[model samples]
Target: MFKIMIVEDDHKIREIMLENIKKWGFDGLYIEDFNEVFNVFLKYEPHLVLMDINLPSFDGFHWCNKIRALSKVPIVFISSRDTNMDIIMAMNMGGDDFVQKPFSIEVLMAKVNAILRRTYSYSNVETDVIEHDGAVLNLKDSNLIYNEKKLELTKNEFKIIYLLMKNSGKVVSRDKIMRSLWEDESFVDDNTLTVNINRLRKKLAGIGLSEFIETKKGQGYIII
Candidate 1:
């Protein structure tokens, strides 16, 4: 069974989520000390994490970055902050998905199940590496290599680049990319995708692979 860590502060919300997580046959771990969020994560080493933006000591973004630095464990942000900037910041901070408060438990569980399946089950058959234009995407470690230099990618960045590199020389539509990245793409903001792509391009450029991913306006994105 997959272990899921809950980093939410509210007592009522945490209990609700805990009940449903157990109902789904997954072990749920909740944090009691906000200051030791990362420490708890290290001790538990959960397969996935459910985080909320408004916490006690540090915001969710800070903890997200701390966890992201060491592990690529799937993280979903659950919060009432519905602003575009909040969503974008969550994505930028390395969250795998975002759920607004007042959300249906059923929908949240669906997203959780979808992400877990994609992360664990689908990975069983995927090749460890994908190469294009002399740049190699290391699937196992989520690093991109080119000219002997390697750069680690965030979860979203890895998925976006992996999709583009897999369909190298082909125009991948925006809808397609969004679906590939977020299983339930309808809840995702359009600008969120742009933010991920731009961040990815900037990272690629850092390794001297400037213009590695091109924008094919009116269509989508391409890597050629």
Candidate 2:
């Protein structure tokens, strides 16, 4: 299922949109802390974003620019302001579409589904690079670039860092990491995974990302 992130601040509207989004068989994600919108977007990596014009701290346009610098994911503006300038600004800010407030949920869903189909139907939507905290993972080259230094990674190291960076604020368990490696035909056992993690950490530290990935006791590892 496609994941959609809702960035509206109104409690009632946000909940309502989420309910309908889930009802339509899509995974809906939202955040209450508006200040962390960009970080949350990076962490979740939603396929599309429903953004609002007015927000706490920074506005939707600010976050849209921030995200646009990183990924080409679709962003649809949903707002109470429907002026010509607002719509133009939304488009200029990299929004794929705009839906004004007091709008039909069905219509919104239809637009969302249409955009998703058009965006993902005939192409791979993953970005060429995944970046966090100044470290850029070049998917095409399997190189980790930090502070103008590039470090080549083995297949297993790439996969491990990809998973960790993709899920940046969450703990990824050892079993999950092992499963991912196994799917890639690496066949890493528990001890092997530990070794890989250690090696990857050392490489990251070498490139000025020391202590980037943290161990979470018995749970797993997290890149926060």
How many collisions between residues are there in candidate 2? 0
Off by over 4 Å in 1: 122-224
Screening candidate 1 with a backbone cut-off below 3 angstroms (N, C-alpha, C), the clashing residue pairs are none
For model 1, residues 101-177, the per-residue Cα lDDT tens digits are 87766557666776887789855433445666557776779988776688999999998998998898999999999
lDDT of each: 0.88, 0.86
Candidate 2 global CA lDDT score: 0.86
lDDT of 2 by residue, 1-224 (tens): 78999999999999999998887678998889998898888888899999998999989999999999989999999999979999999999999998888776655766676678779893543345666655777778999877568889999999999999989999999888888888653555578998999999998889888899999999999999
Clashing pairs in 2: none
